[model samples]
Each structure stands twice: as structure tokens, then as C-alpha cells.
Target: MSDPTATGPAVPPLDADVIVVGGGPVGATTALKLARGGMRVIVLEQREATGLEERATTFHPPTLEMLDDLGLAEPLIERGVRADSYQFRDAKLGKIVDLRFDILSGDTRFPFRLQCEQSVMTRMAIAALDEEPLAEYHPNSRVGTIRRIDGHVEVDVQSGPRRGTIRAAHLVGADGMRSTVREQLGIGFHGHTYPERFLVISTQVPLQEELPDIAYVNYIADPVDWHVLMRNPSGWRILFPAPPSWGSDEDVLAPDNVLRQFRRVLPDRDADAIDWVTLYEVHRKVADRLRDGSTYLVGDAAHVNNPMGGMGMNSGVHDGYLLAEILLRGHAGEEVDADLDRWAERRRAVALDFVGKETEGNWSALRDDDEQRRAAQRAAWEALGADDEARHEFLLTSSMLSSLRG
Candidate 1:
């Protein structure tokens, strides 16, 4: 562990009202909200500001509305692909149905999914936080230990040459799944990991000519294999399951194996058609609780699920907003302890009941080999598209508006 008082000019004052760990999108959102509320906030991130990876590229409708409230939606929409409709298809049977987001026009001003890399949102939020006089952002900073003293939270951080203890009224862990803050707090992260891993391949090659009817987002279901094809500002991305039987990670990501996977989408394509590839395991874990006295958890620190319905990042954004809202209430002199308890319960329920179930159901339905279940799933999608009322309800849930409203 680095000393708490190492010297560097990058370090700000060793105190804040809120100290946020992990400067990803969720952490940035939390810091931005608290700073906007006039709280002294410090965001410490392990990585440099410009080095964020491209993850969680799909933004649901309510998420856009939330970004709009922060004056961030318009620029993102300008840079992203507005996916008005997304299709569910059978590999053998072709398109089953296309769920249109416009059905939610009456419910939200932005009625479409925005396909932009999550790094974009993080960068924007960090930039916005820069304008807030109360906000201090430190990149290349990794949080070490966290402890509570005298009803105040203290965080030990090492940022390049600087290492110091920062005292704060509260700490929010917006870090990723392997959150240092959460682990140090001894919070139980309970859930199971899927038997298979997910493989993502991004390509610069345009696929529209080959798949004329393909929407910006398409989930192609097969008894033996299911794949998700999506378009972001970068290019087209294809995601599919990689079972343990597929040998080691190196074997699964071999050039020949990767080309074989791409050939499934384009038979004529060669190795040159691919841009980059990655493999990650999916999980359905949720932290036992969101609060441990003055410390809190948000985003993947609180819950993680398969990225089937694109709910992971979007729901994480909602978590940041909700927690900040409740804390702001407390800052305004309201007795928010009861409200804090409610926040924990409400957020956990949203993670497990809404996000986990929906994403898992999606993954299950797409790859299910059972004829009866597949037929029922097909029928349900067909019916949803045939009736405006049913489509409205489905879109409400699909757009994640219903998740927040309830």
C-alpha cells in the first residue's frame, strides 16, 4: 500500500463531501449530480481519462431522458445511431418481429435506443463535472482502503506520485464488477456465473447490403447458436455465446475460429474483415446491500447481469441518479435515513426483478432448443407486434420506462 501523504501537485484538498471510486460512467454521473447540488465531490479513477474502453453501447429511452436532464442527450444522439426498431429473428425462420420504439412516442420525448459507446457518456459527464466548482476529478487514481470514523468516511487513494487519505461524509463505489471499495467493505456479492462466456467481434465492414432487412439492432435466435448484431458509432458488433467446450480463451479467439464465426454472417468475408475481438464471462450477481453506513455502491458494484437487453449500463445510470436524488434530499436537511433504506431496496429490486430477469429471459429464449418454448416465444413476439396496445406495453418495458415508473 502507498503512503497516505505522498506528495504531488495533482492532489486536491484531502477532504470532500463525497468521494466516488471508479471514474466510469456511473461514478461520473454520481459525482456530477452531487457537485451540481453544491457538494464538494472528488472522483478517483484507476485509469487515465482518455483510456476508457468501449462497453455497453446501447442506451434505452429513459436513459436518454436522464442524459437530457444533464444536457448530454443531444450531442450523443448526434454521434450515435438512433435505433428506432430492433428485431428478433429465428436463424432458420428469418425475422419474427420488429419492436418499434416509436410506440413510446407519447411516453417519452426520445423514443429510440441510442447506440453509442459508454465511454462517450463517461467523457461527457467528466467534462460537465469540470465546470462545477465543487467537483474535483483525478485520473490515474486508484482507491486503496475505505473506513468509517466518527460517522465520516475516509478513503485512501494513490494517484501517480500522490497518495493520501481523504475524509468525506459519504463514499460511492461506482467501480466495475471487481470494485475495490465493495470488496474492502466486506459486502457480499451473491449470484452465479453463466456456464458459457460471451464473444464480441467488432468490424468496420458494412453489413446492410448483405442483410437488407436487418434493423440497427437484431437478435438472431437459433437452437444451437444465438447472436446479437448491433451498430454503434464505431461499426457493427456481433456477440454470441462461447461455451467452455470451445477450448481455452486463446483457442476460442484464434484467427481461424474468429473468421469462422464471421463467416456465419458473411460467407465471403475473410480475416481482413474483422476489426477487434474480445471475450468476457457474464454474471447475474447483486451485492447484498447498497449501503453500509456512510458508504454506498452503484453500477456493477451493486449488480451485474448479462448484456442481452442492453440494460447493464442504462440501469447503472438510473442507480446513480436515484442515489444522488436521495442524498441531495438529506443534504437539504430532510430525514432521509428511511429514504436511504428505501433506495437500497428499490434499487436491488430493480436490478434483480427487472434487469436480471429480463436479460436472462432474453438470453434463454434466444437459445432455447425446446420446440414448445421457442414456438411460444415466437407467438408472443408476433402478438406483441400485431397489437398496438400490446406493443405499447412491451415497448414500455423494452425502453426501460416502465422499470422507472413502477
Candidate 2:
């Protein structure tokens, strides 16, 4: 909905304390936080609404703590399921290593992982923003151009029948992987795509009767068709790493193809219950810089990691939180240039050192057919299984609690 006052001729062509160029979770949360802090915020989304197609269903403990700070923990708990542990299986050894979330019990309020669709979180954030007077949501509004003049940032926007300019003290590009704002600012996103593609299928059948009470991330480390299966409220989400020679643009979501892959990876599941399937090419990329003057990039606009560890969405939300804090500090007459720099540096370190490495390693372990690679994986798991300290360290890393530290 357009703001009436903002549409009047008496009003300035563009006016806002901050302009967020993306209505995804990151941008929406940043705008909502700013509005809550009494700053006038405007968010522009190219999409008709904030309903995203891809699903990032796992929220780690640290991310849950950040959501709690935003007063969203209760609502999220109501709408999502909790995951207590992750099970890493080495089929060659017939050994399963259980990494529990209890290690973070003393460090954060949310010691367990939460499984909720990205769409659900977006809808919640949108509703929260709607109740804030200082926040205005502009869906179907695409940002065409951006310019930084003097001390203010200007943006050319097109929404339905209207085309206009928006000006703000600060601008944020939380758009996505192919961010228009990032392009406009000449920030380079550097990384390469994995040769292998990933196919994700969602099914309604109950695949956890053996461990019904515990929600664990299952990593099947088979060289032929390594996969991950996660439990959701409605169904189980299955992820398969396809061979490098798989089809590129063709529809891989067909039931036959999905069933074939499912049978190949997880032979135990019932194929008749498959509901939805999607195939995506995985890319590991990060922006060269997070900020340029009054404009900053957050979420996928800044970095995109493989979804193996479910860190992509979690890291994006964390970016929003960090940016919101810095912006609020700046608004309160604090010299936050150093704070902003630290935010970017620390985030990039975590993304590169933890998320990037873990996801890439998971991909390699899944795809490697060499006997040496299999033996190494077996040895690593054996060591991890024998030592509780090692198991906890692995859990902390997978749960993203380890990366929460500065």
C-alpha cells in the first residue's frame, strides 16, 4: 500500500531516514527495526509480495537469539518445529554420530534449532512492519537506478503506474544474489558455481518413526548419491547432490525424476508421498565490499553460500541484525563508521571461514568417489564419535553457535 502523504505534491519526491531495497527477510527486518526505533523507513520490493519460492527451513540457535531480541521468538516458536540434534551418518562404517544442541544451553536462550519456511518468516515480518507507523512497505516497486549525491542516496523506482525517485539518509541493498543496488554501486561478487547441482524434494510421508521425538539433520555420506534429509512440520525435505553431468535448464522437478533420485539416495522412503520438488545450481560467492558511503549491502546481496549447512538464510538474518544495530547507533549521534566496518569484517570472516568451508567440504565429501576420501571421512567421524568434546565442537559449528562470537 502506498502512503498517501508521500504521494502528495507538497511532499518531497523522496524522503526517508533509511531506504531498504529489498522486501525479503533481511530488508524487512532492518526496516522494521528502524521503524521501531522511531526512524522513518521505506522498503521497496520488485515482487508483488514477500513470498519467496526457495525454502531455507533451519534457524540455528544464534539466529533464534537475534530473533528474540526483535521480540519474534514466541511467534516463531508457535509457527515452527524444534530440532534438537543432527545425525551425521557414515554408511561405509555403519556409524551415526549425533551432535546435540545442548552444548549451547549456557550461551543462548534458544539451544535448539528451529525449522520454519522462509515464506512464513517473511509473512510474519511483513505483518510486524504493517503495525509500525514509521514503516511503509512498497511491493511491486522495482529499484531501477541508484545515485549518491552530496550526503544523501537517491533511487529511481517503478511501481505499477507510478515511477518516481526515493531519497534517504542511508540505503541498504538486501535485494538478493543478483542485486541491482550492488550492480549500481559497482561492487564485485566473486566466486564460482559448483559443478554439481542440488535437487530438493518435499514429501508428506513420516520418515522418522525410529527417532520420532528427535529432529535431527541426517547426512547420508554415500559416494553414489549423497543426500541430506530434514524433518519439517508437514513433511521431510530431501536434498541430493547431482552429478556434474546432470541436466542444466530442464525441469528436474518431475515426480519420476524426483522418485528416481529419492530412491537412489534414500531407498527407505515411500516415493508415493512426494509433494514438491526443485532443482538449483549452488553458488559460493561474496561481495568485495559491504558498504560504500551511505549505502550498504546485506544478506544475499553481500554473500551467498551453499545451503549444505543451512547457513545461507541464517547468515542473511544475522546481517540484518548487525546492520540494524549499526544504523541505530548512527541515528543516536554515535560515530559508527568503525562499528560498520567491524560488522562487515566479522560477517565476511564467518561466511568465508565457517559457512563457506563447511558447505564446500560437505559437497566434496558427498561427491568424492575415491577410496582415500571415503577412508578419511570414516576416520574423521570415528574420532568425532569417540570424543564428546569433538562431537560438541562439530555441533556448535553446524548449529552456527560457534560463529556467533566476534
Give, for candidate 2, the lowest lDDT window spanning 10 residues. 5-14
Tell me the whole-model lDDT of each prediction, alpha carbons only. 0.89, 0.81
Number of backbone clashes in candidate 1: 1
Clash counts per candidate, in order, are: 1, 0
Error of 1 at 265 (Å): 0.5
RMSD (CA, angstroms), candidate 1? 4.9
Could you give candidate 1's per-residue lDDT for residues 1-406 as a string of tens digits?
5567887654343488889998888999888888897778989988876554557999998888878878889988998999999999999888999988888889999988999999888899999998989998988888998888778888888765336888888899998899998899999999999988898999988886788889999999988778999998889999979999999999999999988988888889898889889899889999999999878899999999999999998999999888898898888898899888888889999999999999999999999999999999999989988999999998898778999975
Model 1 scores what on Cα lDDT?
0.89
Q: In candidate 2, what are the lDDT values of residues 51-157, reduced to their tens digit? A: 65657888888888877777777798888888877767764544366667777687678888888887887888888888999998888899999988768899999
Residue clash pairs of candidate 1: 4-164
